[model samples]
Target chain A: MTDALKPGATIGILGGGQLGRMLSVAASRLGFKTHIFDPGANPPAGQVADQVTTAGYEDSAALLAFANAVDVVTYEFENIPTAALDIIESHGPIRPSREALRISQDRLTEKTFLQSLDLHIAPFADITDAASLEAALAEIGTPAILKTRRFGYDGKGQARIMSPDQADEALNAMAGAPSVLEGFVNFSHEVSVIAARGITGEVACYDPGENVHRDGILHTTTVPARLSASQRMDAVLLAAKVLNALDYVGVLGVELFVTPQGLVVNEIAPRVHNSGHWTQNGCAVDQFEQHIRAVAGWPLGDGQRHSDVVMENLIGDDMDRLPELAKERDCALHLYGKAEAKPGRKMAHVNRITRPQK
Target chain B: MTDALKPGATIGILGGGQLGRMLSVAASRLGFKTHIFDPGANPPAGQVADQVTTAGYEDSAALLAFANAVDVVTYEFENIPTAALDIIESHGPIRPSREALRISQDRLTEKTFLQSLDLHIAPFADITDAASLEAALAEIGTPAILKTRRFGYDGKGQARIMSPDQADEALNAMAGAPSVLEGFVNFSHEVSVIAARGITGEVACYDPGENVHRDGILHTTTVPARLSASQRMDAVLLAAKVLNALDYVGVLGVELFVTPQGLVVNEIAPRVHNSGHWTQNGCAVDQFEQHIRAVAGWPLGDGQRHSDVVMENLIGDDMDRLPELAKERDCALHLYGKAEAKPGRKMAHVNRITRPQK
Candidate 1:
């Protein structure tokens, strides 16, 4: 096994969005330089990262250079091409491992992996073709969601079906890509556990946060989630189980649905989750730092929340509220340096301290 | 007055030390890009800043180009050359104003300015020559400090005159430079208030943090300092007084001595100060962001302490403790991306939460 990375080591991060941007900032705080690799130009991460390679993941030459320049590799997104991972892994260790990525990249694989651990999850069926899609629909019944098995995020590559009559239209929307149909969860509320595991197999979890979504986009995450003590314990334990099962060496974001029966796993992000953004103001060591510490093989930090925080995302035109939000007492405004405020884009966020209430 | 800067505006920062590094990170969080200018190559600020101009402040062309590229200019140090400021000011506004820099750069001018405002300060006199030094020493008495009026910081360019017999040697230590002889204040302890003034003239101050110096270097700053409620109010009000006196448009660090006679102003920094580092873990909005917000003409944030914190600087060999310190609970580590841990150099710091104990 490789030795723990010392300060001044370069951390190569794949995908250069807000998560990558935040991770870059956290790495710098720990005295580690970050090199960002993304196909997009002027990525948010590039604004703060030490280096930026604006080349597609398919560019093996660029990927090789990135991996070789940094002591270790980590990613902000899970949908990186397996081919790119293969080239990068040959040069350095990739935190969370290739196995975690392989499973998380496909809905079918992710669900099956969770089931293998005997964890509770929504009932799902893999949709390879129209015949199978219809057959799976018959078993799953109505009010289910059709999702692309791969490359689906933020409600993209998804369609909702309320009745059997809509199955063909939903299937057509998939455009012949592999898909998964999940029975709609009867959840009272959604919560996420931001958990991390160090390279030495040590795990830590932040308090679960209750999340609210608008138009399939995360709107806000409030700490002190509406969960009983036992429920909170269950969430953290299950999250730890997943990390250990995957032998993950970085942060994993586990989303769950609170139901009458029990908490059901909805999805998992193999990186810092949006729901945990509240930790930036509420905890001593935030999720980004925890991820950096774990990836660098350093000891995990205290994940305890010091105050009640409500993290609200500034989406697109939500940036309009910034002038007023900037004046709000006990509010910590964190804006991603995105040039344009496009619709549904996460432009910024405000972590408002609700405890020691004013 | 210039209108408030919108998100995505570039902020030009002079100096690229740890303070600049932190300012860059804070500016990025507010969706403002920072361009760091420093004579040193590969400065700590460059690790996270959007851009770095590794050119001397004497390079007027480079300074002008830098100033014209950003919406506003601020600094991490007060010792910037006046000629450079003249060139930069022609292109963009400099927050905290040039007057603040001019006054704070010179000890005599700073003390005189404070005295004019009816603020209590140590008795001081200007010494342009040995004869004047002797005269000032006689008036200020023994046990006074001889300091260079300009370009002195962190115990540099200072000599103590403990007795009349040592006057000649102390004067020689000045090396023919302009100097100031100030009678030291007999105080209980030193504390600093990190205060900010927005362009619109609004003011906000973080709670005073008790300071301790080791060999004239800052050792620790603990917030919720050992002060009565009245002393805290006095500190905040005096800090605000300094900001308003200068019509300051950014964060200022005000060092004060709590004496039996009341609070006596020691020094005022026109930018974020080391004593204010505790705010990073103690308050919702840190000094860096407060400085950024003020410079950007945004509204000030709540500076109230949510958690008590003790910030300790990890100077040089202190880095050896990072391994164990990283494992400490409720500790937030901030390391500057400095390549070498040279003796007396600040490599990193740890803000440990001490309140709501353990």
Candidate 2:
């Protein structure tokens, strides 16, 4: 509004994984310094960040110091502790708002919020105990997933029920935490809209990308998604509706199911999403930069993609293919400098420019 | 020949200015960490680098320590002191080779090296004193430039002569340093090839970019430069010739003059050049990443240009236009977080995607 944060302004980030690492690089590209706060030592983001605080979220003094040093605060992941937000928010502004985090952090709350906007979502019910779980399963039927309401990602903290008989095991997987029962939607495939809203209430949405998951992990995302003009419009419009409804001031990822009847909402992530990584090569401004621009109050890029790209994640042993991938034509690699190649860990991603769609 | 530097490998970089800053970001994208060695405190590159050794190049102990900490060493500036390079090279390999640096650090050596490669270069003579300057003037004639043999950049350490009578003033401009006298080429415009050579002898050259200067500093570099198809091939071939001749293992900038007869060599930079910044948006693999790949013993990118881009530098007061530029469509900004906007200091650059060429 009043001239975006000046070039030297420092941005405080709450998580220091691959997302935080990328956000740090993006901040630098725009002349903004980033100070990363994470409990882990030698966080991936710390390698590229201007400053880093290796302290837990419960360390209020560290949180306060970090907030004081940065002009504004944003985050890489949505599961930030409420108390940490309270401490940091007291010193400086946090983009995307605490309200956005509150909703996305809990599955029940997110689905309810989306439904309130008249957006179609998978039928879901809350579960508090054994009886509640049984009742929800009875109503939602089999072929459902039971997920913990919070602290879940990359298919963690969830269990699938093939039939009503498996409801007990699924509920047990929750470990007695409050949960949500989501009846599987009959959808052809999954797609996601990476969207952003600026401080001036203007919204921009990148074209939806078709997603393919392997073993509950994102395998690849291809732009020029298989979508009719109406489907693309629906995806972008619904993403904008969610952004405006939350008064969001940063990028968000909205995953959807391309069902036979219409598009159905799967979930929303309040920060840059892995599904949007193709934008690093496909668009003039990537999701990380767009998030930084919105949080800094700069004008959003028009979100017009210049190239068609296929982004494939390099998980764990995929690092073995570095030699082959490096030799491949038109492949731009974005590797997270994680030391260990533990199974299922995301080591890097490669975005191959297929061609310019235009 | 072998695998590229592993993701967690550290790359030691000399000269922590904007070039090192960009190189650091590119290394991070490939999952490598960078340690910057700069004399200045809080260098722009330090903000993004994993480590910073704020020690002057003359500090042999610091230079040795920096080199010992990384897998290999590379530099951002060509004017590194011979003693400092000796210290670092004794500890680890220095890419682009010490020979490449030796040739490029001095204007006289660079010209001689290019001529040895059978490349077309401007007529030049080494100048050590008034007699030599006068003799060179007689041979080269008026409208020539006298440039210091070493440590000159951005048109500094040079003086122009329009007539023979101005010889004394031009010689005095050198202030007793070794100098070179060059006859100005009657050319139409300037263009540069951003070229790279891998450790295994593979070479890649980006399409030549037309360069326009303002106050003797690069103003903008536009890809798809005005060149006949044959001229374009000449540019790339000559660039590859230079790279292979030097056994270069990193990116080089080869400036050329478009003349009525043919393309003439203007100058060569052993490291990344400001004129090549357009490749960041125009090519699948940018010059920075290409340089890293070369030095790390990786295969070279195909150097394919997907979009037409114009890269404009933001010098000093040009930072004032950030607000306006931020709002422009297809504009991708890369800003250096220098605290003060000193006159002539390069503060940032913007790459505007003109359109896809194919």
How far off is model 2, as Cα RMSD? 1.1
TM-score of each: 0.98, 0.99
Q: Which candidate has the top score in DockQ?
A: 2
DockQ of 1: 0.64
Q: How many backbone clashes does candidate 1 have?
A: 0
CAPRI class assigned to model 2: high
User: Best candidate, lDDT-wise?
Assistant: 2
The TM-score between candidate 2 and the true structure equals: 0.99
The digit string of per-residue lDDT tens for model 2 on B131-230 reads: 9989999999979999999999999999999998998999888899999999989999999999999988888999999999999899999988999999
Q: How much does candidate 1 score in TM-score?
A: 0.98
All DockQ scores? 0.64, 0.81
